[model samples]
Target: MSAIRFDDVWKEYGDHIVLERVTMEVEPRAFIALVGPSGCGKTTLLRMLLGEEQPSRGQILVDGKPLLAEPDADRGVVFQRYSVFPHLTVLQNVMLGREFRDAKFSARLFGAARRAAAADEAMKLLAEVGLAGQESKYPSALSGGMQQRLALAQAIMRGPKILLLDEPFGALDPGIRADIHVLMKRLWNETHLTVVMVTHDLSEAFGLATRVIALERSRNRPEERERYGATVSRDLEIFPRRRAELRSSVQPAPAGTTRSGKEHQPGRPGALVLKEQP
Candidate 1:
């Protein structure tokens, strides 16, 4: 089943049309990069998927069900700006999401024991993002790259199934950006999350995404600009290794196959073979 489906979706604000007839199915565990010129509504599409805005026509489905009107823990988002709370330390920032969720349905606060466990998880998450020893530092104390890392950790702490990124690495230095790219891939591979990122950098899009989606307006003349909206102009699969891995994981394994995708030898318990004979 598709993790997300945008069905003939259209979005308009009074006389302004942002998206028209945008339809696509994003497979589960897919890393999708949405690229387009400035003001072409790439971020608008991301916002709609995040449930911050609704389509003027048609519908959007998540896991084959209509989306809720507002954002939920099932989705996490990071924007161009570092969104960490400046007043809170790194550890506190990451733990804040869980605290809110725990206190959401119940007014009671977590006891000392529960708080300690949550803190430990937050520490581990910060470590994963390469901010291990900076937990005690405030956002102001860190560099721009470190601040962004904190924002990522905060977004990921809730264990969202979908992660939305809007020009997340755009402001970083070239060297830092490359490092973050590697880290981003590691995070995606290690987690079960599907990612949708909007970036203006084509190189970044091509390097990080398993598939690249380009959005463009069909008519760009001054006379008919507002009358038309952007749609998917190009879809490209640029990651051969990732594509092969995804296909293998989703397809059913042959009978008597071992966990390594090799066949188990017949009449020999726990014996494995490279492949089954024809």
Candidate 2:
């Protein structure tokens, strides 16, 4: 389990401030969605959570441990673009992280048995992400949605404590994006993996998050910085725990299945069931 806490964090690139005095806490196994307009530091917050960037001021802690010096296995990240290697098969690409992180072998003599086990694990994750029977395919052969699924499977193959997604489904069609959302929700329920996703889509945020955080720019002038600072909105909305029926209602049925079990229903938009909570 991982609990994340950001205390008065400030992030800057040279002289440009990305995040200012941003503070929040993410409970263990909590699905937190960071939503905002462009250039509001949502991705920067994800980077800090992933330990890829350090805050210019204040601190962030994960599971009671500081984030700046944590190891890679503690956090898994999936970006909007496909991060798979074109040269390798899907199984091979998924196993790369485990092979480097845990294997003790020379490239000249990588053990067959070890690699096979790793492949099996990767295959299982691929199946979970709806990529079954595609393990032998190369990255170039898959659709954009399938590639993102592969990337996600690769990220979670090692079971990181925290999963960071930065607009991972942004490039996919609406139908595919909705399918990914269902997959993500199922994964979260099954594994209870703490997730922090940065998304520009308000509907996606509202659909997937246990709590949503909205970030905005400060409007305080320099003279009034201390006296009358502009307060950015940080609205938090927790959705009610979704039952299987609720999830099933919105879940896209298996490929080739139809409303009548014979003919497929084309252009059926996936429903997103979001039960709002305080």
Candidate 3:
């Protein structure tokens, strides 16, 4: 099962603290939305979870193990900017997942038949993500939402346990953003994948996340920020699933029932702060 935890995590850049004493846990299959003002360390948390950044003093755990210092198949990421390679066609980009499943040398040893099988699967995934006929087009030729879909297709090809999104829909237009949201909701429903998203849109965060985490820089003095850092100002549980539903339900936790159930006692303003140490 997929799980994540941050134990007193702190991040610093040459004494400029970005995150401080951030302690949290992400249960398996959790849809977590992090909302905060820009430069409040939301993206930093996502990067840390993705293994692109290291915590200065604390530990990050995945499935109860210390997180590695590099990206891995256990976690997949989609950024605000399109991450697809401009030089590669959509199919090629999606096919990279298959090629990466094995070692470079081992992939070279695969017979043409085996390679073709992998290509066929990639094509299916392309179709699944609505890029069926656009596989031959380069990423530069696709629209913003299509590019996002391509990126998502590539990530899904890996079957990662946890998916991380950093402002994934921030740059898209309203209509495109809504479409992407629907697509993402469907994928999450089908995959039961753990998700942690960083978004500035409060409406999107509340509408999409089972848990809403808000971070803010809490320095009283102007110079304190250089030494101090952003902290979890608010951690609200929007909706928690019941134990019975979690055990029996397989589909994505329904839209409003993300954190529904008798196990979670609702708190102020319909937000249950599971842990308040932040």
Enumerate clash totals for all models, in the order shown. Answer: 0, 0, 6
What would the C-alpha RMSD of candidate 1 be, to one decimal place?
A: 8.7
Cand. 2 Cα-lDDT: 0.72
Give candidate 1 misplaced runs (Cα > 4 Å).
105-109, 239-278
Error of 2 at 271 (Å): 29
Show the lowest summed lDDT stretch of 10 residues, model 3. 269-278
Q: Give the per-residue lDDT of model 1 (tens digit) for 182-212.
A: 8888777666678999998999998988778
Candidates sorted by TM-score, best first: 3, 1, 2
- What would the per-residue lDDT of candidate 3 be over residues 169-258, giving only the tens digit for each residue? 898999988888878876776675888999998988887777789999888488686888998888877645311124333445544323
TM-score to true structure, per model: 0.85, 0.79, 0.85
For model 2 the TM-score comes to: 0.79
Give the per-residue Cα lDDT of candidate 2 at 246: 23
- Which residue pairs clash in candidate 3? 239-259, 240-259, 240-260, 241-259, 241-260, 242-260
Work out candidate 2's RMSD over C-alphas.
10.7
lDDT of each: 0.81, 0.72, 0.80
